[model samples]
Target chain A: MPATSSKPRLGVFKFASCDGCQLSLLDAEDELLAIAGQVEICFFPEASSRMLPGPYDVALVEGSITTAHDAERIQQVRRDAKFLMTIGACATAGGIQALRNWGNTAEFVRGVYARPEYIRTLEKSTAIADHVRVDFELRGCPVNHHQLVEVLAALVAGRRPRTPGHAVCLDCKRAGTVCITVARGQPCLGPVTQAGCGAICPAYDRGCFGCHGPARQCNCESLVGHLVQLGHDANDLLPLVRNFNGAAPEFRTVSDRLEQGWPEAGGPPPERIPT
Target chain B: MTDTRTVRVEILSRVEGEGALHIETRQGRLERVELQIYEPPRLFESLLRGRPLEETPDITARICGICPVAYQMTAVHALERALGVQITPEIRRLRRLLYCGEWIESHALHIHLLHAPDFLGYDSGLAMAADHPQEVNRGLRLKKHGNQLLEVLGGRAIHPINVAVGGFYRAPRREALQRLIPDFEWGLQAAIEATRWVATLRFPDYCRDYHFVALRHPDEYPFNEGRVASSRGEAIDIDDYERRFAEVHVPHSTALHSETRPDGGCYHVGPLARIALNRDRLLEPARRLADELRFETPCGNPYRSIVARGLELVQAYAEALDILRDYRDFQPHRIPYGHREGTGCAATEAPRGLIFHRYQITADGLIEFAKIVPPTSQNQKQIEDDLRDWLPGVLDRPDAELARRAEELVRNYDPCISCSTHFLKVHRHDH
Candidate 1:
């Protein structure tokens, strides 16, 4: 990756999620000009109208796979990409739209469109890695700008990008903020949530809603007990666990148990292993 | 003289979503024109079922990245109506400011990155930048300012987590807003110049008596709050959006075609519709610039939509400055919403056009049903009409030229096929 040996070719691919993750790249103000100079920017339709054929050096895939065509398309992207990275919660653990995975997708389709015959979609919205091997996955509802920049820079440097996989509680501790759960008895997903959003909810004098998906080794059972103690009922817990990263294994396990009318204090047989 | 070859223009190079222009003519007679949208439908409405009403803003914001704020605003507004809640005046004003940021950012992206290259005869903004580096830089600078505005108010530009159903998760500090005054001043100058520069482009001479529909406010240009109005003497409240304009499902697109109640044809929204309807409400500097440049109000040509977008950018900057001048501290109040059963509809003028959202909430605060008609779908029919009118005049031009112009016309609308969520191509046996 010499600076003078022509710029690295870049391609942006979208699947089933909202266009927010790709929009994050264009939203980069200071780094955009510098990055534009360093990369060929071969294909990014959201920003530029120009495109080029690719055996690309880096392919940043946004969204998840939600259709038959998209399921096939991810394989082609895998073949073309030298290094592929999935950005945002949708591409990582499935987006909030992944709520379809828990219910009847057929009925969901009929509920939305007047003519279901016209709509071509799969039964579930799945992450990109479910189909193809993703070189890296950035976790966030839409992803943090600093992490986005750092990942792109690391890709150029041919190294694993540094993104925090720790719980939001660590960031809250670092920021020296009081615990909303302990002090105000607010049910927060912060203990199980990723830390990229800068503990924004806690900073804003509210509880974290887990837009960044789940952290590694999240204790969903313990978190649920805390939420229950905080005066949250079944109705509150249902939406809480099923947020941006609702489909992630840990969150989904707890949510599914709750939805099936499991006891809050002690669930039956611990509900088929923790995520 | 049957020239049965299909003029397939796969113009997926610019903007959000995937769409292409398919035109078929046999023996010099136009047989079919289809604006095909190939973007996959995510079924936002279906997924919203069973989710809590509070998550509506955060979830719906995912509809379109370019105008996430618009989605947030419309979703929250609808939720408020269903929950029997009313946001404070200060919160409402702040919402307008946030929308202005979206207008500036989205419009700047279209005018500079997508549409400008077509006007300047370049393949892309990168190509255009080779000759007009300063212009490109200024557009970026202005776009940056808009993103900064969102950062201050909503905490981040795309999929902002700060805003919720009733009000913001946290109110922006005055010092944070005050810091943006310098950038606003600079963007104001840059946008004014950009508008003048865009005005210099050669526009296609075309006009139509469109049923121009928009949200009209009494005191200001429409943003988050306004009454729905049309050029054909139709005005109504937000709740009556479904009654006033009906969406008809066309086979050509997954996105529905919207028209006046009586017919399913074409109408206009976005810059031309707004400037046409609210010319008197343009801010002082924008109004002065319009007079200084002799830029006529209510421009009809679709090509001039680029110019109208540029003007809106200037107005957004001016409005942001005015808002910052009178900024107040965060109000201490919980977002008041109660469980109620109702059907709520809202239409906000997104940077592109009228973005309509309709929702039916159950008694227990669950979303029973949802419908969203983005600006791109609304303009799909009108785009086909423009092609019908402009194609005949420019058909004899080089295929490359015709293709380029055709793509430019589509980009002029800044259509987000992802938001529209459905379009298709037809290969007819007759053609």
Candidate 2:
């Protein structure tokens, strides 16, 4: 939906992730004043106390639904927002805290809090899309500032956001960076993860750990097979895929396959003598 | 006949966590003041058990989004200790520069956004900004420089990936660092002015004889390294942190309250503590500004903490410039250290106060036990003490004035309750 009014009313909402993504918005210090001037910033509790009741024009929602209150809140936000964009891994796919979704919630809760009886939470931490509709998703552990600005501009101008839906391998290639996986035998996640963080890990002479979630065309099977060929066994690949973007469909599928002990999708496990 | 009253203050404003103050009054006198932390308990230690040692830096950084670098530094220091790795001089300089970014950013955040509102009598920063745009803009610009430096060096401002166990995964180029110097020079001037501006605020003349505790380095205002020291004649190395401080669990709140070990009394941390303990170590401009403002040593007044934070911002800017001037390029280090089975005790100044992290690692480099004491948790008892002392005089004031002043008192510490643990539970005295 286009902002028919003079300025778009922006609202930033948080639910269950580490508040890093929202901090990114504030981190846009040079551009922040200009951005504030361009929009009506109706509700951003983290930044402002003067919240104008919304019917917000656009909502840049961070975090995931982890509690009964959050479930209700997300629904209310969706109703209030004309166009709701989920920001970061937590809003699209549950965050690192979503590791709880795989474990027992009651036990996890008991292990964490002293007054367990006072705590109120759900069994699983799920994304905003799991409950209400998310018009678009910005992928990353902490969404890139430049990309965030682009997304906001697009929403204001009534144009589809030009956020790269491409993979990290493409970014690495464009930056003229040599593959750590190919050269140094690092088990990089570049092949399956999204592009936004400018292939930072690879440029640093280390393998990409996939802080940005899975891209649109992730072929995790081939990547996993290649990593195994390079050196990593099932044990290494399990955790590699299960990090920041662990819950995304493509990565999760490959992780599940590795755990289930499937014999290389056809033939027996490749035998290699230890050094 | 014995008279008793329990005053409960829920959801303390101008601080970070969910905490309440419960004071028990018996026989027309103050009995017990327990600062209760009700923030949802996060088992960072327990969660870290099975995870690999390399993942500790990023995992621990999640403890506080605002001061992620503090977490990163402490975690990396502990890991380096466990792994038997020593970072090079160049790496140490870069680490200090990164830490200065956090200090500038975090201090600007508290002094301008969270703490300033209380001094100016506003609900929040945005409201205060509307009334005083230029002042707010100046703060934002100073904060911008800090963010810019962090982004250029650490890759991202929060939970930066550039820092690792041995050292930074990537060393920032000299050119990138040089580009920051001009803006930082401007920020230094602005920060000095900001210190003066903050000092001008009508600071409520309320002082306490707090046993201020902070990391004190002989040559510098402690950022990355220091020996823990206090106003009340207590100094110890990082290893003796647990011996000096003790954490106790109260029946009212889930979060534990920390105090001096033998005496078991509350002590304060953060700017007031840091500034008071390291007064002589402050940089030239900071020292000059402190003198001009007449912010003498042993500053126990909690309200002057904002002024102290502003002064620290100036010190941070100077430190940043010093690092920039002494810039040198170095090859990235990746010397893997052998992990040992032992406990690591470390304390670094987080933006809010002294953040202590102690972890027991297994031989295989996995965390067996983890205990973190954030600044806000440490200040709980001291906060209640301030309320108990001040409330008697203000009990006759209108409810609105009393509540406002109470909130202002809490704001003095610039408490990042979100980082530490918050509902302000005030146990007021009955006339």
Off by over 4 Å in 1: A1-5, A264-275, B422-430
Top-scoring candidate (lDDT): 1
Q: What interface-residue Cα RMSD does candidate 1 give after superposition?
A: 1.8
Residues A78-174, candidate 1: write the lDDT tens digits: 9999989899988988787788888888888777666778777788888888899988888887888789989998877778788999999899999
What's the residue-level lDDT of A219 in candidate 1? Answer: 88
Q: List the residue pairs that clash in candidate 1.
A: B253-B423, B254-B422, B254-B423, B255-B422
Expressed as tens digits, the lDDT of each residue in B1-431 for candidate 1 is 34555444554666787677777666666666778876777778888886777778888888888889989988888777767678888888898899989888988888988888887877777667779989888888888888989887877788777788788878888898988998898889889999999999888777766667888999998888789888888688877877767777666566767776777668888898888888888999888877887777667777888888888898998998899878878774348667888878777888888887888888888888888878878888888887777777765665566666777777778888778884322232124
Can you give the TM-score per candidate against the true fold? 0.94, 0.89
lDDT of 2 at B163: 78
DockQ of each: 0.62, 0.29
Looking at chain B only, the TM-scores across the models are 0.95, 0.93
How far residue A112's Cα lies from its native spot in candidate 1, in Å, is: 2.0
